[model samples]
Target chain A: MVEIRMRVNGVSESLDVPPWVSLLDVLREHLGLTGTKRGCDQGACGACTVLVDGERINACLALAVQYTGRDITTIEGVAGGGDPHPLQTAFIRDDGFQCGYCTSGQICSAIGMLAEHGAGSASAVTEHVAATGIALSGAEIRERMSGNLCRCGAYNGIVRAIQDVAESPR
Target chain B: MRPFAYVSAPDVATAVRAIGTEPGAKFIGGGTNLVDLMREGVERPGTVIDITALPLTGVEELPGGGVRIGALVRNAHLAAHRLIRNRYPLLSQAILTGASAQLRNMATAGGNLLQRTRCPYFYDGAAACNKREPGSGCDAMDGFNRNHGVLGVSDSCIATHPSDMCVALAALDAIVEVESVRGVRRVPMAEFHRLPGDTPHLETTLAADELVTAVELPALPVAATSRYRKVRDRASYAFALVSVAAALEVDDGTVTAVRLALGGVAAKPWRAYEAERILLGAPATEESFRRAAAAELAPATGRPQNAFKIELARRTLVETLRQLLTEGSAA
Candidate 1:
């Protein structure tokens, strides 16, 4: 077992884990932060999405030992001080999900997607690769959020929830 | 996943030595592909050397107008790099088209090039795959082959290389830089990946002990105007059924310079050398484009489920060139 230290949801935690244990298992089993669901266990499904240093990645693909000393954010960390994140509220208002199995991942992925877009990152559907300050069009949101899958067929609502958060003024 | 000893390398030399000295040891970068294969029991490394801590994680400009990308540079960062977006937009476009936003965030440049084929047979332990196990008969040959290769295939195996970025790199005339205890060597992009002849197990020119340090993209002005077109089952988050990476230069309605490479059709990124030769000094027209595509694909062979790839490749190549031609004229 290797001793690993990391900051998850603003708490510094240390644990001894085997080399092969995935971050998903460590978060779910070791720390009991089960909000990060494991739908596919592979990278195909976005149900295990989490933020490492503010960038979204699949937790199932990351080895727990590899993420030493990194700041990781999960669904539990999204809302601060007993208030729901605006995106979370929007998800509920727009009915972004039916079963809610993919809700945590979708919310985390959207936060990262918005951060990437704010940094002027281009998506596959972007007309001009060099253009900066890309407008958050519905097509752009759909393309950027394609990584997260909502199997309950709530794509229309999910897109609408994200759009509401993106269009709302800070 | 099997239990493996893990060590974090401090630098390049340490990483190389760890892999060289330990038997059945593998280097882990972004862990996107390697970890998945490990979970599926496809890869069984006894020692996993974590090299993410090595100081090789940025894109730098070479002395000559080229760009040298570090091995650990993540795909998402590489695509958004200012130099890549402005100079090699097609490369940026290609990287964006592959996988998804989350996977790109976790995948590295070196890991992307070294990723194995997504062949179902190779992943299925019950199925026979020469790549997964030597002397094992290939089930993809007679099995569901709609996603298999049509070019550079052998009877022993028929798997396609599954990287959109490599196709663009091939067209841009990139170079792969690798290092080991034996010292460093530079391999041209064309020679980096190997054809699946009798030894389908040997995928790349990289030896087991060697570590990919970086990939260099040589200065090519044509790459600025290049474009990558991937035709897949869906518009987003799907591997290519047929893809084309093309850059064209026309002088007074005559083709002066051209770079063409294909993906989802061969064991390696199929650089269209025959088509490039045919297009040089020829009239920049759809007729010439179609003829060149046909000449390059004449030697291609396909199985029943994948026979459509030949025609799909042909049409994709022609259409891509035509688009480049139109863009050139408009400019």
Candidate 2:
């Protein structure tokens, strides 16, 4: 077993796990941080998405041992004591989720996506590859969020929520 | 996943030695593909050698005019590299069209080139897939062949290599540098991936003990007018229905040179040499583009559902060539 110590949701935690133990399993089983839902054990569904060093990644695809010293932020760690982030607030205001199982992933992915675009990362739908921070079109948003599936198909509201937060002031 | 010993190799030499000396050991990079495979019980490696921390992540200008891309360079870095964007436009476009943003950020050049097929039959263990289990009698040949290969496919297997970077690299004539316990060797991009002839299991020429060190791309001056066009079912993360990576040089209304490669149609990155031969020195017209595409697609033998891929591949090529010509003329 490999021993890993990392910060999760601003809290430092350490644990010993086998090589096969996934970050999703470690979060749900070992640490009892069950807010991060697991939709698919494979990497297809983004229910287990979490922020690893400020970037979102599918927790199911990342091994627990691989994130020894990195910083992890789960759905539970997004806001302290009920004050939600702007994206989370926009989701609540826009009724972005019906079941709420995929909300955590959606919020985390949006936060990362905003940061990616803010840093001038281009998406597939970006017409000018060299352009910095191309306007986030609806098509771009859907394409970027394809990894995260919503069973309820609440996509229109989710896109609006993300767009609202992205367009809002800092 | 089965129990395995975990060892983090400090460098490429250590990684190669670890794989060479240890039996039933496998190297792990970003673990985007290998970890998922392990979880699904597809690969059962006794030892997991971590090579993510090796000093192999850089995109530097070669001694000559070309670019030397490290094997550990992530797809995100490649897409953002200024030199690659300016010189190898097709490579950047190809990398952007593949997978998702998150996956691309984690996937490396070596892993992208080495990713296995996403064939449904192979993923489903109950189904007979020769690529996954040799002599299993490929169930995909008759059942659900929508995503299977149509060009350069054999009776043994019909799966296509699932990589966008490889399609562009094949067109650019890139070279893969590998380091093994014996020594270092280079494999041309054209010969790197093997067709699933009788041995559908053996995907690439890479030996188990070899670690991919770097990938060198020969500089192409005409690459300034290159493009990568992929036609997929959706606008997002779906795999390509038909993809084209094209670099063309037009001078005085005539095609000076052409490098055309295709994906989602063959077991390997189907380099369209016939198309390139027909296109070189030909007039920059849609008729010539169509003719070249036809010459390339003549050898394509499709199954029941994938017959559309032949026409799709042809039209994709024509559309890409037309766009390039139009872009050149405007410039």
* Docking model 2 quality class: acceptable
In candidate 1, which residue ranges exceed 4 Å CA deviation? B328-331
All models, DockQ values? Answer: 0.65, 0.48
TM-scores for all candidates? 0.98, 0.97
Clashing pairs in 2: none
Candidate 1, B176-258: lDDT as tens digits: 99999999999999999999899999999999999999999998877777788899988899888889988888899999999
Clashes of each: 0, 0
Clash pairs of candidate 1?
none
- The CAPRI-style docking tier of model 1 reads medium
Estimate, for each residue in A25-136, the C-alpha lDDT of model 2 and write its tens digit.
9999999999899998677778888988988888988888888899999988988687888888899999899999999888988888888777777666666565564788
DockQ for candidate 2: 0.48
Per-residue lDDT tens digits of candidate 2, residues B116-190? 998888888889989888998898888898887888899999998888889999999999999998999999999
Please report the candidate that would top DockQ against the real structure.
1
